[model samples]
Target: MSMQLNYNWLLVLLSYAVSVLGSFTALQLAVAIPLAATQRQKTAAVVMAGGAMGLGAIWAMHFIAMLACDNGMDVSYDASLTALSALVAFAACVAGLMLVGSGRFDWLRLLAAGICMGLGVAAMHYIGMAAMMMPAKISYASGLVALSVVIAMVASTVALWLAFNLRGPLQMIGSALVMGVAVCGMHYTGMAAASFEDNGGQLPDGYAEGLRGGNLGLTIFVVVTILLVLMLVLHYWRQRYRSSISI
Candidate 1:
């Protein structure tokens, strides 16, 4: 039973690691360059734009990642369902945008963003699951799994955002990486929580084993090392090639 629980934990961590590494890296690539391009005078605009770009990129990455994984399979799931979900999310976002722009205390904006994220992540996973579903009948277990994923993602976002804000901007960049991992971790944890049977089949296990066997630890080490080296080399190259912008 303990072993089963451990395995379930492992599954969550593994899934989170995938999101952090894949989606986060994509986020950096998507947002960082644009931020660098903007001058200090336009800092606020750049910052906001960078954020919008980051979230947009994350969504794009999630969709494409699932679609890529779905390759050649019969994704006979209803296109309208996915479309409607996206439309609702868009409308919600628009409303949030208006609320924020209207200059009220904007409590609603935050709530809306949270709801948008939860639904967006949930819809993506459900649609992906639908695409991946075998002809076997759907069950309540599936709905629970979906709920778990959504809750985990929303929790992760809150956690990561808190962690990021606690740190300053320089640290915020690193926090974003942490946030990425948290997002992915939460997502997969949710996936793992899904009970396949009414009685709840043996709880999952394997945090350590999954870390090693799943190759997540190795992948993180390799990727982070490479990215660090790349960053160092780029830092030096930039110093040699371009004058630093004076604040």
Candidate 2:
């Protein structure tokens, strides 16, 4: 039997909102990379930006979207795989940000960075998907899977371009919006790629010990709260710095 999958629309919206907030925060940090006079400052900015994008925008949003999914089964996540997915997301974002943030921005760098970030997002999504533990076996359609990856790469490229190459408020706002598209589009598309089949009600090993929806919900709440506070801090810091510079 094939499991009928559905989603909570509100949680889906919340996932997108989290993605935008994370993107805005990351891009705000990213715009300062070129202005960093020291290698340490540049490295710090890159790492921070990477964390925001990877952990906050990509990983957190992925899980929230997962929570929004109701696959008509009792599902839990493998803690180890879940953690690995997050690390992958963080590492990929860091590499992409570092590549584009260093030296002069060029087309080649942007292309490479986009590929890195896009593939990272895709990989994180699938890996996170793999973390699901239920009485069903999952599979993907090759066509939609490929489409999801392409959507990620193309939109991620566009988002990075908007993030680093834009001016004033548009710099943060535009990239964040497009990046939300990159994150959410790839996600739902990937979800569309998946088909779940029943396995005679046989649950995977350790399903009893896996992280449940309640656990994930609490984690996501904390993450969103942190992201909101970070955005506010960034806003305040930017305002004060601008005022001081103009004085």
lDDT of 1 by residue, 118-212 (tens): 55556555554443232232233566676665664464345323322342445545555666555554445444543332223322232222111
Lowest summed lDDT window (length 10), candidate 1: 203-212
TM-score of model 1 (CA atoms): 0.43
TM-score of every candidate:
0.43, 0.92
Model 1 lDDT on a 0 to 1 scale: 0.39
Query: Which candidate leads in lDDT?
Result: 2
